[model samples]
Target: MPKAQETVLEINLKALKHNFEYLKSKLNTNTKFLAVVKAFAYGSDACEIAKYLQKLDVDYLAVAYVNEGVALRNAGITKPILVLHPQAVNFKLLIERCLEPSLYNAKILNEFIAVAQQEKQTSYPIHIKFNTGLNRLGFCEKDIDYITSKIAETSSIKISSIFSHLAASEDLNEKEFTLKQIESFKTISKNMIESLGYKPLLHICNTSGILNYPEAHLDMVRSGIGLYGFGNSEKENKNLKPVATLKSIISQIHHIEKGETVGYNRAFKSDGFLKTATLPIGHADGIGRQYGNGNGFVTINNKKALIIGNVCMDMIMVNITNIDCKEGDEVIIFGEKPSASIFAQTVNTISYEVITGVSQRIKRKLV
Candidate 1:
């Protein structure tokens, strides 16, 4: 546990370990694990999380872009870092740092091969991303032959692995779609292996994929939001612990008389005499302005406090009437109790959006 601060994001390492262990329990001993550290490890400090995951001996680390992989490399992370979306322009920097690029298209493939050959590289490892119904950045089934031909022409780069993304792994209602994706991935991978005469490691499962589609855990499994302590369902979630706790303190308490307006544009007005606590956190801290006017809330003194009035860029006023709190009382924006997922649903979103939306400017400390 960390001492309360005006505003802080506490990352519980113990919870992270628990989540990791639980997820690892779902995998076979032969399968490898990759931890997704993209989006600053979903806004919990990428470098720190990557370093810790590396210590856990994760087979791989993945990020959204080249800069993120570079950041991990600069932080002394030695695990193989995969940049999910690598532009041709950053091929030089990516190769220079030993960061792997997931070549999802022809331009990326051609451009990367050119750079690798120019650098006189031999057997440079690269991942091939195929489209398995995600309709995202990846080569389609029709392009498999062309991709194999291109790889055959290159000595500078070698196929490190092949992967695809699952579009609806979380929703049980979308089970058919997820299964179709797995089937397509299997067909494409089988063809690629026959063509190359050797099987490169194959992986397609994201966090939810690992939980819901255990049979599809090819050569490796990637854990993202799941690693952050969410399981995409009530039952799975019950066993995992939330790793990040967003906390703040009551900067002051104010007494409001009946009919008095509060905050900008009178978004909230007192109906009667009440006590409100001003918390030093707001939209800029990634809580967002829409999370106000009573739609969103915080917890104080183990009681709910509705967020009254429009959320400010740096502060929020909450109705604390009937709560036994005072100035400097600790407040929980979202954590193990209310959970980030529950809070995000109030805003018509998901846990990933809620956690990743947390502002990087806010301090993050590992416990």
Candidate 2:
């Protein structure tokens, strides 16, 4: 790719393919792959990512809301899209778009059933979510009987899969908790299978779960961060290539003398003569305010230029006194060298937050 002329996010499909194949290599030959393309494919272009993944023969796609699924459908994505958190209001639209919903509780299940029945649909695929441990969403173990009974009463919808979310599959310190969650999911699956008299597709592993727990890779595995080139650990990260590279160009250069302040609220007072490079990217572009005052740094001409003063809404000034750089020079916010994970660590956040927080206003170039 050529040097960025302006603030841009370069989405490398080759890197995405590499990450997908790498994650798939860990799964069994028969296991299915569900690419989670929610939150605009982790702040990249979801439609483009979904199109590429669909070409790669991904078994399924998942989005967090009905509108997201509808967006993919509008983008000509015909794969089975699992709406991970479908709401009652959009049940009609969800069905019209052929998007499957993950019914987690009694009210959602009953409401969806009513909508399916009203739509005169038959055997519409739906996923049942069980709250194994992630207490965020899903039915409790005790609700299995009610769920089965509710299913028995309606043929309008059918259980396509049973799934759960793992809270801490990435942290080894929570191994005991993760194992218990997996074991609980297994028990729930058994009971569900026995009650329903047939087995639905069983899956509970997310990207971290796919990396950390091989025993729990049931029928299918869902990967979000892994597909975006993060493994959630130092060892696994080495094997995955980052898919997004944020790049910008120096808009101007400024020479600051001692006692001169920079940016809003006079956040930085230069102690000595120095030069600064202003890049056209800031909080609005996802480089938050927390990454100011020497906390965050960017790469310029192969040198690390610390971000000085407070970050503005549309620009950030980085000290580049020693670096051999000029206006219009390429600047790297985060990429393979200073990966998103490393950049996010400056503000005590995670790659998921940083990557997904990128503003949609920035132009995305797919390569």
Candidate 3:
């Protein structure tokens, strides 16, 4: 509740640790915990989050692209970094920075092997991704022999782990599909293990997957949103402490008479004498245009302030007629009260989109 700038994302390290420990408590002692820090650590500052996780002895860290892994490396993160979807052109850079790439196709596998050989690298760690059910970016069941035979030809790179992604792991209704995915992954991985002659660390569980599929914890587990403080279910969310609280100060206040319009294109017309407050946040800052037209709300003075007009690139207007607030009054966009999950639901999205969508222009203060 300290005085904040126009807009800020306050990251409570204490709450982050609380959620981390809570999720870790659900795992067995031997399960390797891999923290996914991709997308700026879910838009909470990747370097800072990865540094904290490294201190906690997190076995692995993951990012979507190679540059993200490079940023963490530049920040002095030396843990096993996984580039989930690496391009061939960055293969040399990945090797130079010691960032392991997840090779899901023959092109990436062959390219990485070529680079490793050129660098005289041997036994470098690389993760294998399989398309169990998600059908995103992963090798198929038919690619088992293709992968095993190819990797066996060279000692430049070695299989560090074999992993897959669950499609509907959190949905209780998709329990049957989740089980099938797990079984398919097991079958594919068994073929891999027998062919490779060694068991690389295997994993397929995201946050929801971890909560719903304890039996398939395999050799390790990966968690992203769970670490940032969100469970897929309301019951689980109650047990987790949300880590980031988005707050802003009321920049300006005005009183408009009936028939007066607010924002661009007369998107909102005042029904009566109404009070509104302008905030220094908008679509460019991650609360996009779709949130306008009364679709979003902010909390001020413990009262709900519905967004009354179009969300501009750098500002938004919220109805504050019912609340006693001033120009500098603090407002909560998403926090302990509205909660990221609650705020996201108001806009037909999830907490991940809301939190990670927060742009880098807004300063992140790690409290």
Model 3, 294-346: lDDT tens per residue?
A: 99999998899999889999999999988988999888999778899999988
Report the C-alpha lDDT of model 2 over 1-367, residue by residue, as the tens digit: 6899999999999999999999999999999999999999999999999999999999999999999999999999999999999989999999999999999999999999999999999999999999987889999999999999999998898999999999999999999999999999999999999999999999999999999999999999999999999999999999999999999999999999999999999999999999999999999999999999999999998899999999999999999999999899999998898999999999899999999989999999998
Q: How accurate is candidate 3 locally (lDDT)?
A: 0.92
- Give me the runs in candidate 2 sitting further than 4 Å from their true place: none
Ranking by lDDT: 2, 3, 1
Candidate 3 ranges with C-alpha deviation above 4 Å: none
Judge candidate 2 against the unseen true structure and give its global Cα lDDT, from 0 to 1: 0.96
Evaluate all candidate structures by whole-model CA lDDT and list the values in order: 0.91, 0.96, 0.92
- TM per prediction: 0.98, 0.99, 0.98
For each candidate in turn, give its C-alpha RMSD to the true structure in angstroms.
0.9, 0.7, 0.9
| Cα error of candidate 2 at position 226, Å | 0.2
Please report the TM-score between candidate 1 and the true structure. 0.98
Q: Give the better candidate number (1 or 2) by TM-score.
A: 2
TM-score (C-alpha) between model 2 and the true structure? 0.99
